[model samples]
Target chain A: MTVNVSVTVNGMRHEISGVEPRLLLSDFLRDTLGLTGTHVGCEHGVCGACTVLMDGHSVRSCLTLAVQANGSEITTVEGLGTPETLNVLQTQFREHHGLQCGFCTPGMLMTGEDLLRKYPLATDEEIREGLSGNLCRCTGYQNIVAAIRSAAALRRENA
Target chain B: MKPARFEYVAPASVDAAVETLLAANGEGKLLAGGQSLLPLLNFRMARPAVLVDLNGIKELSFIELRGESVVIGALTRHREIEHSPLIASRLPVMSAAMRHVAHLAIRNRGTIGGSLSHADPAAELPMMAMFYAARLTVQGPAGRRTIAAKDFFVDALTNCLEPEEIVVEIEFPIPQHDGWVFEEVARRFGDFALASIAVSIRRGQSGIEDARVAAMGVADTPLRLEDVERRLCEIEIDVRMPDRFCEWVRSSVSPNSDLHASGEYRKHLLGELARRALKTALAAKGDRR
Candidate 1:
């Protein structure tokens, strides 16, 4: 049966009707809303490629049903920054060459945003642990760790 | 992968949820957090005709101390337990095990009740629940009833709850032990443990007064090593105690081989992890003294 889903995405409210109860949040974001920046990898949720912010907390979109997010506020990769101006974490990712294929970049950026906002992230080990759910095979996670570490330092400096 | 088409209902109260499940006639699956259930749905391993969404039941999401017990609502998320100052101060072993649960993203949306209900043999929460001797309260069409953790888990990925029943909350008695430790070895930091151990010890004037030992990923279900606990209390605390306990633990469980690790390897891990956990708990007790 189709269900009505109303959600606020990146501060913009979208009311979608006739959404299948089985539609995943990942598909809803990508196909329905045209926010393809949120990548879907390993739809079983082992890969963090579908990570997004649900009410300021990072959650696996693939594991979340679209109907489940009816009243929630979601933040996808598209919400982070634009081509003209990148957010701090996005800038650090670009500088450190965090993405080799860019398939896992969106998930990494979203998870990084969640970590930078909440954690002290004083150590590289902490950043690595925070990024454990999101896998990156191309760079072997060295540059991703570097980028997040840099962003964490910048956050500390600004605070 | 996507789930098969199913009807969805968001019930606002426990009564409503129970009623929905009853009306579905065992075809309804309770959805909490959606961390474990969603994965099952995505794989189409579980095809329930009705998905009863319990997230709207705000009353089921809570962590509070009532009387001598720390009662945690079934809907309480792992991340909430991880960051709770109350859990840190009271059930410190649980606080420590939270890190070994899934990654931060999964933990944020995963509920303790869902984890316990999922009853994954390798998952950390089931092991913790057994370690704490938690009691689960389940509500059905008949009414609410309580089940001890030992009796609650029937098998891997299975609980004793009837299809129409839902776990309302888990009540853990505040431990009065002198020391506690949770040790796990996962291939990756956030992966399911190969074999993990949890130990809690209470010291008396003479020696170890009481000991609680449990292990995961080594059997059909999370196991409480009563024989090992008895042996631990019988032996004197020394450097060799871990070695002795390791041998006891190795002999206690017959783990099955899987792609992650062999049964023999898991047995070895159970031994070593038990040794390390026991030693750490003893040392913590020593420091307290």
Candidate 2:
């Protein structure tokens, strides 16, 4: 049976009906909403490629049913930046060459945004630990760590 | 992967939730944070006819300090416990073990009650609950009842709750032990532990007053090493104690062989991890003195 789900995605309120209870938030965002910036990797919770912010906290979009996010505010990769202007974390990812294949970039960016907002990110070790859930097969994670570290530094400097 | 078709119901109250489950009649599955359940659903490992979403029951999400116990609603998320200053000061061992639970995102959504109900032998919360001797309050058609952590676990990925019963809250008595430690070894930082050990020690004028040792990922369920604890209380707290405990731990558990590690490797880990945890806990006791 289909369920009615209303959610605010990237500050835009979406009231959708006939959403399958089995539909994943990842699929709902990508297919239904046409926000393909949020990529789906391992459908299981392990791969962080489908990570998104639900009410400002990172959650596995693939693991979350679309109906579960009914009344919540969600922020996908599309919410972060545009082709004309990039957010601080997105710019850092580009400058540091954090993406080799770009498959894991969206998840990495979302998770990075969550970490930067909440954690101290005082050390590279702390950054690595925070990024443990998200996996990157390329770049050996050195560049991703560099990107997040730089973004965290910028956040500290601005504060 | 996608879950098989299932009807969904989000009940606003615990009584309503119970009634929904009763109506499903053993075919309904309670959906908590969905950290673990969703994965199982996507894999089609669990195909319940109905999914009872419990997130709407706001009353089941709380963390309160009551007298000498910490009463945590079953829906309390792991991230909440990890950052709770009260948990940090009162149940430091549990706070320390929280980091070993999945990653930050999973922790944000994974509920303590869900973790205990899912009951993966390698997961950290089950071991912590068993270590603390926590009491779980559950509600069913017959009404609310309490179950000790020891009796709650029936086997791996299994709990003693009847199909219609739902966990309401868990009560952890703040331990009086002066020192405690939780050590785990996983292939990756957020992977399921290969084997882990937890130790809490109390010192007396004589030597050791009491001790509790528990091990996970080395048995069918999280184990309380009573024999090891008894031996620890009998022995003098000294250089040789860890070694003695290590040997005893090595012989105590019967771990399964999986793709992750051999039973022998898990046993080895239990021994070494136990030794390290015991030594660290003893040093913490010395610092307290």
Candidate 3:
């Protein structure tokens, strides 16, 4: 059956109709909306590659049905700053070499953003703990943790 | 892997949700947090014909106090419970266990009622609920009924709930235990527990007033340490008292051998965990929550 959904995506409201009831929010963002920044690595929820913001809280878009996201606010990795003007987290990721193959970069950035905004990430262990949900095959989590550490410091100074 | 094609409805009210569940009969699944159910659906492990979403039922998203019990709605998310001041003040053991349920994202969408109803053998909340003397309220076409935590869970991924019954609320009795402790050992952070111990102790001026213990992951269902609890309550607690009860705790549980851990190993771990948790609880007498 078709499920109609209207979601405010990345600040822009998209009134889309005829979505399948089983269509994952990640698939909708990638295939339907052509905003492919949200990756679907495991399809299952184990890998955090599908992380996105639902009402400003990070949720697994792959596990979330598009119909369930109806009338909700969603923020994918694309919602952050563009390549020319990278967001602070994105810039820190680049500076710390947080990506080798980059399959998990989007999820890492999204989770890092949520952690920076909501938590007092004071130590490397705390940043690593905040990032436990997201999985990175490359970089061994050391660089990703380093990037989040840098972003947390920058966030503090700017605050 | 994608979920099977199914009709989805988000009922705006609890009564409507219960009605929808009745209409779908045994083929309906209630979607509360969607953290666990969605994974099961995607793997095709659960193929419900219809999903009755409870997200729109705002009334099922509250945490309130009634007398000495904390009444939590069916849709109360784990993240909310973990950070709730009421839960922190009243049932800190459950709150402490919520951190080990999953990471932030999973906990953000996972619900207490959903987790308890899902009834995974390795989950934290179910065992903690049993240890804390909680009750689960379920509403069906017939009417609403409350089930004690001891009788609610039946087996792994199964409960005593009827097919058409929707779990509406969980009432956790705020026991004035002097100290409480929930310690779990997972393969990795946020993974299901291999074997965990939850302990609650109340010490009077003379001796140990009361004690409760429960375990998870080692058995097909969450288990209460009736023998261990009884043995411990009979004696005056000391630093050496908890370690002496280790043998009773190990013998009381019948753990099954699995790929992750052997039954013998689980027994050994449970004994150690019991000793540690008991000692910690005894040491932190009259601790908050």
Q: What is the lDDT of residue A48 in candidate 2?
A: 97
**Cα lDDT of model 3 by residue, B29-125, tens digit:** 9898898888888999999999988889888888999998999998888888988989888887887788788887888888888999989999988
| CAPRI-style class, candidate 1 | medium
Candidate 2, residue A97: CA error in Å? 0.8
lDDT of 1 by residue, A38-153 (tens): 99999999989999999999999999999889999999989998999999989999999999999999999999999887788999988888999998879999999999999988
Worst 10 residues of 2 chain A by lDDT: A38-47
**Local distance difference test scores for all models:** 0.90, 0.92, 0.86
Q: Write the per-residue lDDT of candidate 2 for residues A1-159, one digit (tens) a residue.
A: 898999999999999999999999999999999999998988989989999999999999999999999999999999998988999999999999999999999999999999998799999989998999999998899999999999999999999
DockQ-based ranking: 1, 2, 3
Runs of candidate 3 with Cα error greater than 4 angstroms are B285-289
Task: List, residue by residue over A28-144, the lDDT tens digit for candidate 3.
Answer: 999999998899998889999999999988999988999889999999888899889999999999999999999998898888888887779998877877888989988999999
Candidates 1 and 3, the one with greater lDDT: 1
- All candidates: DockQ: 0.80, 0.79, 0.71
Q: Give the TM-score of each candidate.
A: 0.97, 0.97, 0.96
TM-score of chain A of each: 0.98, 0.98, 0.97
Off by over 4 Å in 1: B285-289
- lDDT string for model 1 (B1-289, tens) is 3898888999999999999999999899999989888988999999999999999999999999998889999999999998998988788888888988899999999999999999999998898889889999999989999999999999988899988899999999887888888888899998999999888899877668898888999987898888888887887777888899889989999999989999999999888887887788877752210
